[model samples]
Target: MADAPLNGIRIVELAGIGPGPFAGMMLADHGAEVIRIDRPGRGGITIDAKDPLLRSRRSVALDLKKPEAIAAVRRIVGQADGLIEGFRPGVTERLGLGPDVLLADNPRLVYGRMTGWGQTGPMAHEPGHDINYLAISGALHAFGRAGEKPTPPINMVADFGGGGMMLAFGMLAALLHVQRTGEGQVVDAAMTDGSALLMSMIWGFRGMGRWSDRRGENLLDTGAHFYDTFECRDGKWISLGAIEPQFYAEFRAVMGLDAPEWDRQMDPRSWGPLKAELERRFREKTRDEWVAAFAGHEVCFAPVLGFDDALADPHNRARGTFVEAGGVTQPAPAPRYSASATVAPTMAGERDDAGVLRDLGFAPQEIAALGH
Candidate 1:
């Protein structure tokens, strides 16, 4: 608790799906005070009692359709350092929690909004999910085999990267501004904006003719043999990433390709044949054998580990990369800092509303009035 980086920060989260919850979790995991306003009753999709993703935060169930509930939220917002919500453009406005209303009362509050298409674009009001968001951003087009439709990358690209990460970034940016200028502003975190921003390097590559827009045709897209996964004799997979020439040479040496034909490592025309040959060689050894063969070498190899296997990995276990909370195992705090490293807390339920109200400097009578 002493090292909690965000210990004094207060955040009110308007509960929603996917990215919103994730963003809240990130802030809470770093020791910020996050209170999620849940839908009254066990409505919609219910979180499992032991859901790790929902840990480290408190919940306050409120039926925002009622005036009393709206008043309660406005009260909480009055004292909050920030607020995070992931809803479509007009949803908050209809609920009477729009930026203008909140900012008028709390000029220093950071109002963070997370959305798929953003607040003003034509697609802002359209209904879409992760795959659709990525497709619009050209990210999905670059993920599959040559001449094949791109496969979705397990919702990581759009939801977490584009959504949650963007929200967190915007919140932090706004918070910084508020601290310096004594003013709060709304943070518009659009998934399209975030996902497209993430693709800047790839776009640069394409503009420079170093990368192809076609799927599976770029060096880092698994088009090159040196940067792909290969199956071993044991039916397990191993990833190879020897991008630099020196590393490629080390890979070739470990694979016993020390002769004339192996010298064409950079010849574009020879890559296909070389990759085929390497595949054949890789198939002759089990995954563990391949791992052993290059244990101390700079071949840049790692076994394709499943979720469970990743937890037990020596390197991961050594770093305490995973932890158990609420009877569920999940990822630990990240982007470590020596002075203010975040620590995960073990809790699965919302703190009592009255208790949190007191912590926010509200008297007992004000807390009781919130329920009325």
Candidate 2:
């Protein structure tokens, strides 16, 4: 889409892996001009220009080891609305781009810092990953089956959802506040806090005594027969989410389970038997067959689709949730709007450092003098 929502806003993204880049990408997709400050040369890392996460941003490779590079970054920051970084607490301060220095130069700069344990606390200085953060936040413990070990959701919970998305939300909120008061603030986005916040509904259930501590023993976790996956004849799977009584009744009808035992729908004791029976019955037909059988039923059914299958799913195709760009098929910009348009992802190119510097208000002679 053209003329995105964040059209003229500029963001300086200190190029880092994981959540930092993700946050930058989110802003860029929504129309912010995100200038990614990458390291000069490959810098021991293989450059994948086709990576979807690197989209919708211009990049300038600058070696922070040089004094001129640091000066250049400060100059760029002078004109940026916000800056994002995901590093250890003291790393930025040591690099001479600390909050105090940058904020002093640009009082309206929104300094966004994303981390696993946050900027302070006992574990703040320690290095960790998505699983570590989720584990501490009680999110990981709430996943998977009752008797099985805790299973991480492929870094979705802590990394993208908790870290990047939380940072983006905080950045926007702070930006709004800055607009109102002309006072920018630091946005400390931590994965642990976000993961815990994401469990607000579950926490509410626990407080109301409707949630169980055991993994997968809760209502939405795979404890109930009607809210789980069933393996079919062809080894594929189908999911059911008929929680309400009426929906459960329809589900039972679609499954042809009219026995009196099926009447004990909400009883925990009946779940085991119902699950076993479902396992046996579901094996009688292929996943597609069951999908067709319950096509028009209010049974809340969907076949378990893999990545490739999902790319071809009718609903996904109809909504254009994914698109092909730069010869790569990836997810499209989401949470669509009627007034604001979402921009297509952009690929990183052979960066023109001098060009970027010039755009950042650097003179051509100054750019040439910077060893570009």
Maximum-lDDT candidate: 2
RMSD of 2: 1.6
| Stretches > 4 Å off in candidate 1 | 43-46, 361-372
| lDDT (Cα, tens digit) per residue for candidate 1, span 171-261 | 9888989889999999998888888888999999989988877788678887787889999999998999998988988988888787787
Q: Cα-based RMSD of the predictions, in order?
A: 2.1, 1.6
TM-score of each: 0.94, 0.97
Worst 10 residues of 2 by lDDT: 39-48
Residue-level lDDT of model 2, residues 288-349, one tens digit each, is: 99989999899888999999999999999999999988788899998798888999776765
What is the lDDT, from 0 to 100, of the residue 355 in candidate 1? 68
Regions of model 2 farther than 4 Å from truth: 43-46
